[model samples]
Target: MDKNKFIKDNFGISDKTLKLVSEAEESIKEQFKHIENICEINQLRVMKAFADNRVSDSHFVATTGYGYDDLGRDTLDRVYADIMGAEDALVRHNFISGTHTISTALFAVLRPNDILVSITGKPYDTLEEVIGIQGEAGNGSLKDFGVKYVQIDLKHDGTPDLEQIKFTLTHMNVKAITIQRSKGYGWRPTYSAKDIGALIEFVKEISPETICIVDNCYGEFVETEEPTAYGADLIAGSLIKNPGGGLAPTGGYIAGKQKYVELCAYRLTSVGIGKEAGASLGFNRQMYQGLFMAPHVVSQALKAAVLCSAVFEKLGFEVDPKPNEIRHDIIQSIKFGDPDKVTAFCQGIQKGAPVDSFVTPEPWDMPGYSSQVIMAAGAFVQGASIELSADAPIKPPYIAYMQGGLTYESAKLGIMVAADKMLRKE
Candidate 1:
């Protein structure tokens, strides 16, 4: 189907909605110009630095010793720390997923029987099982270790209730507080790193000894500032998301104060063996390039989300598009009432994946979330990629939650193609 016909048939966007989408696209294009200019300036600096031999071209290999081991990975870690404005940073390819990174951080800080206060209610579906919440049938991380867990749900406005947070801190022997930067799944609203900073301050006031940790997975590089920038004790994230810049094959990072990084390093590699060994292979280069390209790629994803929202909202679907000055990025959700429409939309999206041509929805036991049906389309070699995921609630009034596109062009194409498919059915 042609683009216009496809849009008309599937999305049913009105003329007013098209006008708004057009305006948003133009605004994004203008923003991209600024991003290009910044990239050019940074690129020139990089080239000059390269010519001057200021940066090493040889890949840094992780060794097994403290100061003597993994000089390359260590140096990269320091560089990342400086970039993220944290006291220390540890990057490792050994972490297969974001959950691994968070688990490492938790293990480093929490002792047996220590309490983990979840400031962001429940975490992503995968993390629920690890934290010993929903999937207790098998031994999980927290359950195996005997760690206590507590959660404080965000209000409908997406703000943590300071009083509730204070109450939880006061009532529990909290060892650490985990706050997710963005809504992991579903169409719930969220706070920016800055907004989260306020909650962090509140938590600290209630429990001075409690360590503050942020699950900074999908949120990396979406904002000019990060949770660490606002006094978060530890911030952990995946290399495959915003920070990966569509470059990293696989990796994760933890950044915070020097002491936390040190402790996490010990937990990550076993206390006796530090990162000086060859734990971080093929990660430094991807991290370097990913960090360099992150802002641009994120901007593209933001554009696609905004455009999709405009189109979907016009078509009479309830959509949550981040406001002009909103903090969270790379998530756009549309509420489609019919399960069949949700399934068809997901299939259309999967057809656009870089790695796979077709995907289908399935029912599974997803920990942490109450949803039944799930669907995803990833652009990576393995199915581990979140470059795009579209799932719907299996209950009545199904709403398809769609997100991804490593590049802005691909994301835009995905939305347009999905819209086209919908229009044809209409």
Candidate 2:
């Protein structure tokens, strides 16, 4: 069967939107051409890292106690470090989530008297709790630990507020500065690697001693360059989000300068038993294979994000970083303006999922977030954003966050289903 027919039969896509999807076919192909260049550059980098680390079939075997001399784990860390152009890296299966890895890094380098500044406005929701910006400060947050936190909001045009950054850097005894490359739940545009590089240069010129860390969850492999290549002191991301290729069960990674990475490792394990102590527990094969496939998987997701933006824009809804704009992350946001539309859109997405298709999603008070959120994630692996998923918060303007498509086809079909349902209501 043809692509359009298959979509119509399977997802019940409307005739009007089917034409829109068909019209978008050529444009999606054209956009993917640019993505091919990005994938090509990143593929070469991944291959070089693997080759330099001498990755072999034997490296896939797991180790048990203490994991000393675990070649697979060591090589994965080395390859990650090399690909990011970092001095060293600490990649392990022990770090629970992206927030855990980021928290470890913060606690490692920051002291009670030293200040931590975020120049990219407030960070993601979970980071607010971790940084002590919300919730109880008694949960051993940075604020409770006596580490001062300051944030600089972006300008009206959505660029970083540089004047405030300079003022903060010149006066405060700032220990580290954080740049969130992804847009998170905000409506702001995602920062490209080149843009992040400029920010890194600006910070260095003001205070060369300050550590610059990037929360690099959904931004990996979307561009040929990464924040680490542009002189970020440290970068952190979750394996389940991007680097896992939708295969890693659970984990996160932090890669950067040898001293900083070592500090994070020390915090992850112990001072004397840093990276050498974590057991691979039979996940070496998936982690290694996942890294090898990450570039291709990330490209698929990027194409889907562009497609989502285009489709939503055509439907008279607001979309951030329109389809034709330069993209640095896979997330695409669309404003629906009504709670009923939000529910219908999410249910439509869930209906197209490969798993849990019979279930319905509803808004509820989810932890780590201020608002009630409804999430539709029917992934082969639980909570894997690298697969097709959509989420939204129950608040004013009612925007839905869509991200991750393991394959471009899955993402395309899912969006068509949601758009069909949403447009039918009109």
- Global lDDT for candidate 1? 0.70
What does candidate 2 score in Cα RMSD to the true structure? Answer: 1.3
RMSD values, in order shown: 4.4, 1.3
What TM-score against the true fold does each predicted structure earn?
Answer: 0.84, 0.97
Candidate 1 steric clashes: 10
lDDT of each: 0.70, 0.88
Candidate 2 global lDDT: 0.88
Q: List the residue pairs that clash in candidate 2.
A: none
| Candidate 2 stretches greater than 4 Å from native | none
lDDT of 2 by residue, 1-426 (tens): 587677677667878988886676666677888987898899899999999889999898889988899888888889899988888888888877888889999998998878999999989898888888998858998888898999999998889999999999999878999999998888888998889989999999999999999999899999887888999999999898889888888888999899999999989999988887778989988888888889999999999889888888888889987878878998989888988888888888888788998899999999899999999989998888888999998898898889999998878888888888888898
Q: Which residues of candidate 1, in runs, are more than 4 Å off?
A: 1-54, 60-68, 137-140, 322-325, 358-372, 384-386
Summarize candidate 1's per-residue lDDT along 23-125 as a digit string, tens digits: 6576555545544464455444434433443447664443342335555577667666765668898887777788889988988998889999888877877
